[model samples]
Target: MTPTSSLKLTWSSALESGDRATDVQHKYLIEIINELAEAIETGKAGQSIRKILNLLKQYTDWHFCREELCMERRQCPAAAANKEAHKHFMRTFDAFAEEYKVSGGSEDIAMRMYKTLTDWLVMHIQKIDTNLASCPDNGCSR
Candidate 1:
């Protein structure tokens, strides 16, 4: 698939959590991931994918930290579960990164990373992060 075609697979409103800050950050992260996907789909140079991978690693780590902090501040009921989820994601991502390195610039590696990230992000935001918005005032409805 071409880059333009890949761009069509973008972040949708279904992922929104009704939290402005989190939504904005999530959108940005999705955009970055999409850029990486597009680069890989379009057969861009290895440098392109490498750059994006580095950016993704950095942004995801930073975002996870911020989200965890927000969960703590808001006393989110699902905070513990959410943190555990983040840890799992980080581990998975690290493993993928290692595979990408070992693949030696193979597009297959990039493709795998793209699929994993897209699936993981969509599920995490919709099912997990959405729960945080409900505790806006640090009080769990449940």
Candidate 2:
């Protein structure tokens, strides 16, 4: 990977979830992903990558739970799909983290992880999570 490429995730209009809190959380997720990309691009070691992964995992869990609960309470139509998508992301992320741990995290795995993360979040936000916009409390106050 070319460290000079300046890989990063930028928030766009399409990412708007119409919910203040959720949108903020999504933005933070993008920030975390960008941080990981920067780390990889700069040739940071496995431990640093692991720390970012851990942070991602924790924040994702919290955000997903809040969002899911809000959707469910609001009787949003896309709640189930959102939860399922979140589960899929967790599994995929865990697998990536595990692979990096086993292989000591080469640039190849790092790039793959970075790509997978950015791709998944974009799709998830546009397709699934955005459905929450119609919910009574889109921001998932709880």
Candidate 3:
């Protein structure tokens, strides 16, 4: 797909960190990202943006809970740091959502949301969630 296809936000196998649960969560994140992109492409940006934001909020919570559980199970030392990162993501997401709403849900706001989410997810998965996949139970390292 072209970079603008919205599929650009997809979670590729390359992004996998060897943890089945984490990979699945990342896939869900990609799905939501694509959904928002599709919504924008189809000119349903307003409704789709809201839906995507809500889905993101829910998914973020679920993903973090699972990551924390995995960390506790494996006694991963980075769990605290990961949780803190999740909190930061939540704060940023909330701020963006509020701004989008306050801006009257314009197309420009939708575009901004699309870019922000896609960029953030890509960076976050590569940097943060992937690390969790390296934990003992994740089969990435000793």
Candidate 4:
């Protein structure tokens, strides 16, 4: 890819969900995204796209499951919508993964995939995850 501009996203308070575990997971997700961007800018993504994307998909699935269960247990209002959003994301990501597998992941496809993933994650955190901050205990702890 080797774009002139940076594609990394900063992890700040603005990205936090006011829950320790969730915030930690979110931070890790940001780190992965940043790593992908670095690889892309170095023209190294083609070699590691499968590993990176698989890791991302696995982590995202785990994270979404934990978040959804917490929300449901805590009776957070965003539970259903969040679950739906997660499903939609998985479908989109799965399609991308399949396409990448078939095409060997071109730089343009990787760049677009990265951008799409980053944008969806940031928006999902800001709009949906922030609601976790108010889920009764404010921590979703058992």
Candidate 3 lowest-lDDT run of ten = 1-10
For model 2, residues 73-101, the per-residue Cα lDDT tens digits are 77889989989999999999999989998
Q: Which ranges in model 4 have alpha carbons more than 4 Å from their true place?
A: 1-5
Question: Could you tell me every candidate's TM-score relative to the true structure?
Answer: 0.87, 0.90, 0.83, 0.92
Q: Per-residue lDDT for 9-120 in model 4, tens only? A: 8876777775788888888888777778888999988898888998999999999999898888778899999999999999999998898889987988888889999999
lDDT of 2: 0.83
Query: How far out, in Å, is residue 55 in model 4?
Result: 0.5
lDDT of 1 at 74: 82
lDDT value, candidate 3, whole model: 0.74
| Ranking, TM-score, top scorer first | 4, 2, 1, 3
Cα lDDT, all candidates? 0.78, 0.83, 0.74, 0.85
User: Which candidate leads the pack in TM-score?
Assistant: 4
Q: Report clashes for each candidate as comma-separated counts.
A: 0, 0, 0, 0
Per the 3 Å backbone cut-off, how many clashing residue pairs does candidate 1 have?
0
lDDT of 3 by residue, 68-124 (tens): 777767667777777887788788788888998898788778778678767777876
